[model samples]
Target: MTLEAWAVAAVLYVFRTLVDDDIPLNAGCLEPLRIIVPEGSMLRPRYPAAVVAGNVETSQAITDALYGALGVMAASQGTMNNFTFGNARHQYYETIAGGSGAGVLRFGERGEALEGHDGADVVQTHMTNSRLTDPEVLEWRFPVLVESFEIRAGSGGAGRWRGGNGGRRRIRFLEPMTASIVSNRRRIAPHGLAGGAAGACGRNYVERANGERVELKPCDTVEMQPGDVFVIETPGGGGYGAP
Candidate 1:
């Protein structure tokens, strides 16, 4: 249902420029569109089917799919980069930002001047525009240290309109707890359009106190002893046009 809502909005966004009539939030806009979801499908699973990931990761995938098919833009980072850590007394959840696909406009079109447009870095695209907790606030509340948070430059696809770059975040644990990563676009790269290049895939891992690094799967839950560092490299958005 959420995917359908986002898809509808995306379609409207691209078409609004060609039409003169206003498409109001009410029936005037929504009535023309119909959404269907099989009750048993993943989009609409059975009761208590554990579809929490659907809200975060799967939702973005659906939007990415829409973006590709509609030719509005390239794919954005397909994951929310959500992570959670908690002990008996405290729980913390944060969603990291990523790159956004470059703008979509044909040459000589109304927006032709933006042919060299590039995707925005460290953005929250398609899904909820969630803002991460301030590093100072996070460190003050949790037994964790914000080691680094920076842009993963060049991670985006190359094109006339280059794809956006993803981000990197590393957090060091100061105490023992359990941590989990829920994300996607690790295997499949975000696709490009109009002969553009595909975005780079994301990566995740843990660095133990001994400095040994262990790669994390798309979804993993692991124990984190004191001094362990968790690093998430979010996926980059796809390019919109050929370089």
Candidate 2:
């Protein structure tokens, strides 16, 4: 079998093992679903192609693509918002969750409005379900302080059904350290559907002790100094329908 097929099989196997066993734990469960991976594409990268982002970023893109193809709403913040920082002795890594896209509103048989579901807030979904680190644990283990963690208001797209909001996280360093960020949706916003507005784009930056602000790209690695502040504003999800 092709590499893509193998990967899908492995994913399905793990999923089956984790979920209920009501359905037979065999290949029959996958018989009904059709999966296609284009040759040399990101999903099926050719030899020597760097696939570091495939596990986190590309997988989210694939999920968004599938949802978009079904004319569902718009794309979510399609990144894992991976962040890592460390010194010579201590290292830390985290995956921050972003917003989820809103879907089209449903109607009843009598043409009456039904209960429309809103997108999820700052929470992980799909393939990446890792939990956030506790603030107390972080403070005890690393030379950093959690400045703030809160929902970013007015970040989701506007529509009949609004999308979920992203989150903002700020951290202050107690000592010099090195940091790296692997994320996406920095340049382009998550798209909306059916006349809905696009969601806000993500941002990564640093504030020096001298009050200097430096913007960072989607994938960046930088050296930081003591008293420097790192901030991450995750992207919001797109809206579904016209207002």
Candidate 3:
């Protein structure tokens, strides 16, 4: 099916599962929602398109577009930061989490104006709710070593209500393997709203056994040898108001 069709189906399923009212799970629930997919667009790619990344990356873009159209909030980190590695023997895939966008400002109980609500930190939004693999489990299951995993400090935008921070993960290969990454928000930072500041852009890099360092594109596939380290720095959310 098309990316747009898949997204609509996933969303409708979630809505149907969440409603507690006597409404039945049927096509009628989707009547109030209008889904439009433009031809040749990212959400609706033409035939022969490589849509592997659309399931994770483009879904977040669709969420951002919907939020923008509704004037609900600023844009979040529009990526899922998918990473994969394997040899002929085994393969593993993972989706690293990023930050969500901030909501509009509101008044405090004391009658004082407050900044917008802060976005979620290092989480899967929209239709994705998958959790990160445990470091111990990942290390035991693959020919890799977890060097470090932590939040990227000060990566969030500066504003009255600051955005949530992204995550940083580094892994070292124990043996030669093939690696692939599918992600976004590398060139353009997450957008801000109401004069807020934009969030930091994400980065990906590889450290070779020979002490050479190379930056990877947002979407890329590469071959790796032993002692190679792969690092991913996810994007932070956009701030909601002026600082």
State the number of backbone clashes in model 2.
Answer: 0
lDDT of 3 by residue, 1-243 (tens): 668876787557545644667787778899987877788977778888777755677767766656655445667788989899999977999988777777655557874546458777777766567887899999898989999978887777666677778889899999989999988999999887766677789999999999999999999888989999999999988877788
Candidate 1 structure lDDT: 0.81
Query: What digit string (tens of lDDT, one per residue) describes model 1 on residues 168-210?
Result: 9999999999999998999999998778898899999999999
* TM agreement with the true structure for every prediction: 0.85, 0.86, 0.85
Model 2, which residues run further than 4 Å from truth? Answer: 1-26, 104-115
Residue 180 CA error for candidate 2 (Å)? 0.5
Model 2 lDDT per residue over 1-243, tens place: 444654575456444533445787677777766667788986687899876766677667666666666555577888999999998898999999888888755556874435455567776756578998899999998999999999988888887778788899999999989999999999989887667777899999999999999999999988889899999999888887776
RMSD of 2: 3.9
lDDT of each: 0.81, 0.80, 0.79
Point to the candidate with the largest TM-score. 2
